[model samples]
Target: MPMEIRLVRIDDRLIHGQVATVWAKVTKVNRILVVSDDVAKDILRKTLLKQASPPGVIVNVITIDKMISIFNDPKFNDFKSMLLFTSPRDARRVVEGGVKLDTINIGGMSFSDGKKMITNAVAVNSEDIEDLKYLNEQGIKLEIRKVVADNKVYMMDLLKKEKMI
Candidate 1:
């Protein structure tokens, strides 16, 4: 079977209200893979996050290490999985570790000190900007978009303006 994955969105708040309410329904995704080392280590947190997901959706919280192991396995490619990551560092780690994917959709990365605000909903620090540029150089599409309906913001454009890339 040809497996399909949609909306590889990077949001700090993983599997939350917006994800469950908007992105999940819009993408018609059946599986959600949250790639986070923190969640993977904590059994209680993983259980809570799993419970937060809607009834029909199969949610899996896996560490970067575990994700790499699974991604290397051909059998893992059989399922339609939407990959979610918390930060650009994690995303870069996954890519650097050889997790292949075409595009990465950026959603809500909140504003923090030392991070330049991309938009009201999105922000980027020097590290994240560099990561985005690196991903772009790797021929991966880096799009900063809030939702399916929002306009696509290219990482290259953001880099040029911010001079971070």
Candidate 2:
């Protein structure tokens, strides 16, 4: 059984305006799996996110563990799905745990005090950069593109320019 999963966008602000407006429309995805341990346990946030989703779209707030299990399961192989993660660490963990996928899109990772700004839209803390390097080392194609319209930026290019990786 083969699955049709495309464009795993990593954005901390799950189910936001950008996601609903740009990604959902551009990708034409009907199902969104919010793969995060935090949201999975928080009933309030989960309910709000589910309510915020556009009609005809199904949203599932699940943990990384659940995602790993589901990815390995033979049943979901027939489903057309889109996976969303909140952070680079979670993304790296999912891949390291054997959730085999090719490319990941870095959508909007906000800046913190210690984070080095990669682009106008993307910022990276040390841990986040390390996670990206780990994903790159694993042969996963990582690109930084805020919206469907923006030009794609490779992690290696950003890393080299910033001297992080």
Candidate 3:
């Protein structure tokens, strides 16, 4: 069962304005699946995320492992969805778990400890660089763009320029 995962994004603020309002309209995916262990366990955060969803679009905040399991569950594969991850490592894990995705959008990763600022609104830690490099080496396309209005900047190309990967 090829899950209709229209887009994969790594946004720390899972279902924020750009995703809730802009990208959702751009991708036209009816469902939003936020796959993150931390968010899935926080009831308050999960509720807030659901509330932010655009009308007519359903949102599900689920654990990373559960998300991987859903691929085999026919009931979960019925709708087209935009997949969200909080980190590049998790995104890599899901693809490794067998979900089909050729391109990933680097939406926004907030600067935190161990993270190096790559581009404005985008940052990468050592693990993030490693995982993203792995995805690129495995033939996945990576783009860092905040919204539809911004130009699509292929992240791997920048990484090469920086000698990070």
| Best-fitting candidate, scored by TM-score | 3
- In model 1, the runs with Cα more than 4 Å from the true position are 1-4
- Per-model TM-score on C-alpha atoms: 0.88, 0.92, 0.95
* Per-residue accuracy of model 2 over 1-165 as CA lDDT, tens digit each: 445677697988888877776787777777788999989999999999998786677888999988888885777775567788989999888888888778899888888899878888788888998898888888889998877888888977888988886
Question: How many Å off is the CA of 69 in candidate 1?
Answer: 0.8
Candidate with the larger TM-score of 2 and 3 = 3
Task: Please give me the total number of clashing residue pairs in predicted model 1.
Answer: 0
User: Candidate 2: lDDT over CA atoms?
Assistant: 0.83
lDDT string for model 3 (1-165, tens) is 756888889889888888988889888999999998889999999999999999889999988788788877789767789999999999888878876678999989999888888899888878899899888877999999888899999998888887887
Query: Could you tell me the C-alpha RMSD of candidate 3 in Å?
Result: 1.2
> lDDT for each of the candidates?
0.82, 0.83, 0.88
lDDT of 1 by residue, 44-69 (tens): 98998899887678899999988777
Whose lDDT is greatest here?
A: 3
Ranking by TM-score: 3, 2, 1
Span of ten consecutive residues with least summed lDDT in model 2: 1-10
- Winner on lDDT between 1 and 2 is 2
Question: Which residue window of length 10 is worst by lDDT in model 1?
Answer: 1-10
